[model samples]
Target chain A: SQQGEEDPQALSIQEGENATMNCSYKTSINNLQWYRQNSGRGLVHLILIRSNEREKHSGRLRVTLDTSKKSSSLLITASRAADTASYFCATDKNTGNQFYFGTGTSLTVIP
Target chain B: GAGVSQSPSNKVTEKGKDVELRCDPISGHTALYWYRQSLGQGLEFLIYFQGNSAPDKSGLPSDRFSAERTGGSVSTLTIQRTQQEDSAVYLCASRRPANTGELFFGEGSRLTVL
Candidate 1:
């Protein structure tokens, strides 16, 4: 499958700590995006890093991409209970508009 | 709607029945997508629509699953002869035609087949 896969299916962290999740895909991509889903419903876009870029940061979230390795990682600094959610990585391949998503990482922040 | 909107947030039906899910994408967005997620599972790509171009239904699991985007705006996903395995949350998302590639999603429609 061309879908991406996330490592460490689940993670738990204390408030003020940092949480990290990694994703690996199998094909060339135009860009990679991170999304957060609360209560298993809609997913909210977090960040996007083009294949040409190595890293990008948005607010408390930081994303890094290594196209040669076909891997990407997301780091949430100063985690909070409200940040508990499933994080997904999506890849937009160079050939199409469809974005394939990863299995996702479930995150829990202890208050 | 300020964001993508979906109808019938939850639905329960018997096996062999047919069901349709609706999605209203954010106005002016030209790209729309459908995905299904089972409990504790990853999102499964279903279909994609980009403006007036023909939809890419390559990810559809079977002929029993089909989707249509009308006038490049609203979309509908139909499931025929539903099975227990078809019980899942169907999510819809839309994106602007710009290069950002960010997708805005709806709350999703949950379907249960018994």
Candidate 2:
């Protein structure tokens, strides 16, 4: 079973709008990471938030984590058409080194 | 040379046949991972290898699936007596075990069983 589940399976918005996606996991994790995938291609690493950290930012991306709730969110500011892709959240459990991924959120940006 | 590379970008084989997918990790990477993704579904972990340690095969779906990494760099996933259910994109990723945070992914091999 997938360790994480993402909400809002699909979203559509115009360029320059901000997009938010949420992820919930089952167990304690050492860290959580986000990735983006274009159609039929490899996934690209976006941002990683450690269990000890509550929030992180990278350029236009912002990530927040709440260990107590076992959930996380990724926010993209000033979204662009190129940001249209499937976004996945991956979690690495504290006990194991392997990481499990969520179902993912598909975002479509209208130019 | 700089990123993970997977071979046989696309494959088509008949049922009951065997297929092999290969992955080459980035130079000097210590951890290698294999995952399977069905259309519009989440990635399913298959196997993982770190350094010379024993591989984690807990995620492999069945005995028909097997993977091997040589020199801790290149890995191959082989499936025997393939079935239509085995059709999916197989992705390979690599990272430094110490980091345990980010992973670099390959373009993946799309397998289709007829």
Give the best candidate by DockQ.
2
- Candidate 2: how close is chain B to the reference, as a TM-score? 0.98
lDDT digits (tens) for residues B1-114 of candidate 1: 899999999999999999999999999999999999998878999999988999999999989999999888999999999999999999999999865578899999999999
User: Please, what are the lDDT tens digits per residue for candidate 2 over residues A1-96?
Assistant: 537999889999999999999999998988999999999999999999999999999999999999999999999999999999999999996854
Clashing pairs in 2: none
Provide the lowest-lDDT 10-residue window in model 1 chain A.
A92-101
Question: Each prediction's Cα lDDT score?
Answer: 0.93, 0.95
TM-score of the A-chain for all models: 0.97, 0.97
- Mind giving the per-residue lDDT tens digits that candidate 1 earns over A1-111? 889999889999899999999999999999999999998579999998999999999999999999999999999999999999999999977865889899999999999
lDDT winner among the candidates? 2
What is candidate 1's CAPRI-style docking category based on DockQ?
A: medium
Q: How does chain B score by TM in each prediction? A: 0.97, 0.98
How close is every model to the real structure, measured as TM-score? 0.98, 0.98
Which pairs of residues have clashing backbones in candidate 1?
none
Model 1: residues >4 Å from true position, as ranges? none
